[model samples]
Target: MEVSMFGGLVLVMVLVVVVVPALLVGLVLWLVSRSTSDDGGAPARAARRHELLVSSVAVLAAVVCTVVLLAQPVAWPGWASAPGVLQAITPFSVALVLCVVRAVGEQTWPRPRGEVRSAPLARRTIWSLGGARLRIVLVTAAALAVALVVFGATADPTGRAFATNPVTLPDGSVVSGASGPYPGWPYGLPMLLGLALAVAATFVALGSITRRPPLHGVPARHDDAVRATSAARLLGAVQLCLGVGLGGALAVGGAAIQSRGQNLLLDELPTHGLVAVGGGVALLGIAVVVASGIAGLLAAWPRAARHAGAPAATGAPA
Candidate 1:
């Protein structure tokens, strides 16, 4: 459905970006908490409560965003049109179900209280919420990057040029602009780049789960880290699907513009602008993912670096 510029922005920010991660993170946390909370102890109960809270917040946010998305009309033509309110209903329902599973699971999981082995960086990263939710944040950030890239690649460039059904435009109008999914070389570049970013994120999530290189702070041998990474990978895969799939749709717009005898008036700068904006969004995603991955990797490696700095057991202390 074609959505207006403002409508597009809201849909991208709320549905694709915010709601998806919230659902994923809340669900994962709830599941993990449930698995560990076997003893009807205070901690287990508390964890369940926290899970409920996260689920509630996520559901609330998704609902609000969906309402906003449906209420708003898309200003642009093919690129931006008001979507059916029902469009968001399915995802919302899915998110709600995930929340329910997590909340229920939290009540029955085994709870063990051993000395929490500290990861120096993980400690610092989530001093407020703790390490359990750190992976959630990472996954959410990655998803955000994915959405931003998708936005840049698919956004209507030449403003309202695409709004009026092109077939209805005056005769002899040289329509040389692109439209929905897989527009041209312009959109292809972002699609590929965004796809690459999503793949890289998947690799990083895997490494984090396995506690591989760059995930040093993530407790390489810890079960929690593994579980967290698994959740993160799932989220990343979703992000990849959305980014690549949306990009393909945008590229189609470019393909439509391939008519040789179409009106050149359609060759306005706004069309190029929309393409550029979309590309820029993908570029931003690339930057964010690369930077975050580097930061995470560095943070994860501090312990090894410290050990490397130390003298051997047989050597005298510095």
Candidate 2:
């Protein structure tokens, strides 16, 4: 029954991560294509086409990476083995890579031939590109990562099963809920490294986006919108990844605590607090998972950046 339930959960996740986004992207692209087709301006049409092409490629690459990661067999040591590690890392890795690809693609935006091009005098920064939403997401992810590391470090080293407080019974036998799996250095180390790499990749991608030349033949507002959209997407991806990881960690830790409470010996100990604590943690984890799914959806939806009345570029020749 547990296996079946887990399988069902996996199916739901696959649908969320893969099928839903693909359909939405296809629908959006079709609508955009139709709208662009009816317009008769060459420059506008070209800009839209270039945007579509780059977006499609980036989405495709991210989806392909996700599939490969999910399907590949990996052997990881510790309680949270290959599946756990992959679950925690895949979202962030795929999203970060997608951002990088899109940033690189933006650099290649076509310029009009035999025409003078203008550059913006205002310098672009990561903060300017992403706005408040980006900062909030980044700070949240960083906090979660830190918490996970601290929890892992403090946990007793259990190999495969959850570490529980040892209990002594009147029968002169000592028992524990489980043994062998604790989020110790072994588990924490790899996750920390992966997160660090993800942060580095995110900065690199954002830097690329900020530094890329403005799109020519498009209105200044159009160029701002494009950059803002890209930043929003990156922020969404980052939020999704970290949120999922934090949720999973909470769920696992809660399960460990609940297992201890469920031990038959605990029934006679006159204390049932662990059960309540565990349940609360588990519920919070579930909530986080749901929120992460929403974040993923938001990331998939394209939108222009919401700048607070920033002046449009004057299109002065560089």
Best by TM-score: 2
lDDT of 1 by residue, 178-252 (tens): 343323233334333544454444334333333212221222223232233333333433333343244323333
lDDT of 2 by residue, 1-318 (tens): 322333344335645745466567657775756764423246546666666677678777877777776654434345544334554466566767777787788678765444445556465678877778677677756766775776575566542245556668799888665522233455556566767777777778777767656566655555665666666666666666666556655665665566666663345653357677766876886687678667756655544423436676324223
Candidate 2 Cα lDDT to native: 0.61
Model 2 ranges off by over 4 Å: 1-19, 36-42, 74-87, 112-123, 179-184, 264-266, 270-272, 304-310, 313-318
* Candidate 1, poorest ten consecutive residues by summed lDDT: 297-306
